[model samples]
Target: MSKVVLITGGSSGIGKSVGEFLTQKDFIVYGTSRNPENYKNSKFSILQLDVKKNDTIKKAVNAIIASEGKLDVLINNAGAGITGPIEEIPESEIKANFDTNFFGPINVIKAVLPQMRKQQSGLIINITSIAGYMGLPYRGVYSASKGALELLTEAFRMELKGFNVSMTNVAPGDFATNIAAGRYHAPLIDDSPYIKPYGDTLKLMDKHVDSGSNPKLMAETIYKIINAKNPKGHYKVGEFMQKFSIVLKRILPDKIYEKLLMNHYKL
Candidate 1:
């Protein structure tokens, strides 16, 4: 029997790429979008699911189970990005980002665990970000939210082990996607102290995304992980420098790492 895979935020970007790839590979793929009606032409089925809303998560999971009997894999790819000076960003916006990036994935996992536990075999792959590995200028909130999810996956792997449900985190660097357009940006206040530095950093971030790797790279990586008999606890997919940055953080002193980041961002 073909494995039934569920990918959140699958209407476009990395999730859509992964869903389409898996479908081509003969997997029963289902992708979730807040507004499913808009994606009528998707290669895989698009279900209605808003990660921030627990009710919708349950309904989507139940609908998938009803149709497919079991969900063999879950790609927790639904996430929202936020960028601004930490001081300038509203508290509400910070919480909202966490709701989608951190709490949202947790809730979806909670809803799927029972079914996965019952099956005695399942895999859950979380789509985290390379930014999550460190605190970047103007993107602090986004970093914290995704970082929290990365840690959550580490803990979840151990908890789910006895139940035969595997969990892992796949952190991707800048990919050419609509995420930059969809992400929330605190207004660039003309009078704010962070205007110049924040503005410059924001432009650099967008440029990186515009020139980033293809989303298909992420799709291929996801496919490889799914086929692996024993997927590692975490995987990073991105430019050599992006992946190496994580290593540099570990080896370099805190102050030195911070300095390197500051120099890189031209801050």
Candidate 2:
């Protein structure tokens, strides 16, 4: 029997690539997109799903469960980016960011756990970011959302031990993806009061992404981790700087890491 995989935000970028790769490996993949009708892929079936909408999430899950009998893998790859300083970012934007990046995955996890528990086998992979490990200017809220997910991965891993389930968090650095293009910028930033003070920080982050690593690399890495019999708790992908970030976070003092980030952001 072919294993079943469900991927959120599977219409493009890493999610799309992962979905295709998994399909080639013989997994019956159901990939979700908000406007799934607009996208088509021969490798996997696309379903409409808006992670932030409860009705959509419920419907998508139910349809998949009904069709597949059980889900063998759940990939929470749906996420949006919110750029600009956290202080001036509107409350609604902050909530929206958290809703998609954090709560969205939580809802999927909740919906899938019961089926996985009954089967006594499943894997959950979360596409978090290096931002989850280290904070940067203008990306505070994005970092916080992923950071919350990082913790959830840890907690759920320990708690789900007896259930024969596994959790993996992929913290890749900047990748060639639409995440930056999809980032929600506040309206009238030119008219906003905080624009001048933080304008440089936004530019710096955008520049890094423009020269980021290839998304295919991330897809390949995900495949390796997914197939591994005993995957690590977290896998770091991207440029070596991402690996350096983890080491720096561990060995360097807070002030030093803060200075490093500030310098990189040109703040």
Candidate 3:
């Protein structure tokens, strides 16, 4: 029997690439998205799923199970990027970021655990970001969301071991995707007055994201991990600057790193 893999946010970007790659490997791919129609291809089954909605999640799972009988892999790749200083960000926007980035994946894990446990073997792959490892200016909320996900991934990996369900966190540094489109929706308040500095840092990050690692490469890495018999718990896929950023965070002093970040953004 071919392996069955389900990917969230599979309509585009890395999710779509992963779906295509896995399909070539003979896995029956069920890719979920809020607007499945936006990405219709012969490689995978496109299903409607809004990670934030429980009813949608249940429906997607039932549909896939009815057809595949078992799910071998689950990729929680649906997430958004929110930018701006912590103080300036509205409470609702912050909550929404967490809902999509961290909590939504948590919900998916919960919804899929029963089926995974019943099978006694399944892989849960989370598409975290380089922000998961290092804190960055103007990305406080986004970084925090990924950090929460990292903690959850580590804890859940150990907890799920007894059930033979494994979790892997794919933390990519920077990727060429439309994630920035979501950042524009961040709430703006004139009273906060932190926009100037926040905007400078965010602009720099956005520029880099536009020219960063190819989503296809990240997708291929994801496909490799999913098919591996023993996949690492964390896979770091980042290009030059992203990799350097992580290295700097490790080698540089806290004061030095702070100064560097401030200078880079002219904060």
| Span of 10 residues, lowest total lDDT, candidate 1 | 81-90
Candidate 2 pairs with clashing backbones: none
Better of 2 and 3 by lDDT: 2
Deviation from native of the Cα of residue 19 in model 1, angstroms:
0.5
Please give the lDDT score at residue 131 for candidate 3. 83
- Residue runs of model 1 more than 4 Å from their true location after superposition: none
TM-score of candidate 3 versus the correct structure, residues matched by position: 0.93
- Residue 159 displacement (Å), model 1: 0.7
Candidate 3 lDDT tens digits, 1-267: 898998998888788888888888888999988887776654788999998899999899888888888988999999998887777678988998899999899999998899999999999999998887767777878889998898899899999989989898999887888888766344555665776676567678889889878888987888788768888888889887765787899998999988987787798
Q: Which ten residues in a row have the lowest lDDT in candidate 2?
A: 185-194
Q: Candidate 1 deviates by what RMSD?
A: 0.6
Our model 3 lands, by Cα RMSD against the true structure, at 1.8
| lDDT of prediction 3 | 0.85
The sequence of per-residue lDDT tens digits that candidate 1 reaches over residues 149-228 is 99999999998899999999999999999899999999999999999999999999999999999999999999999999
| Poorly placed runs, candidate 2 (over 4 Å) | 187-193
Winner on TM-score between 1 and 3 is 1
lDDT of 2: 0.87
TM-score of candidate 1 relative to the true fold: 0.99
lDDT of every predicted structure (CA atoms): 0.95, 0.87, 0.85
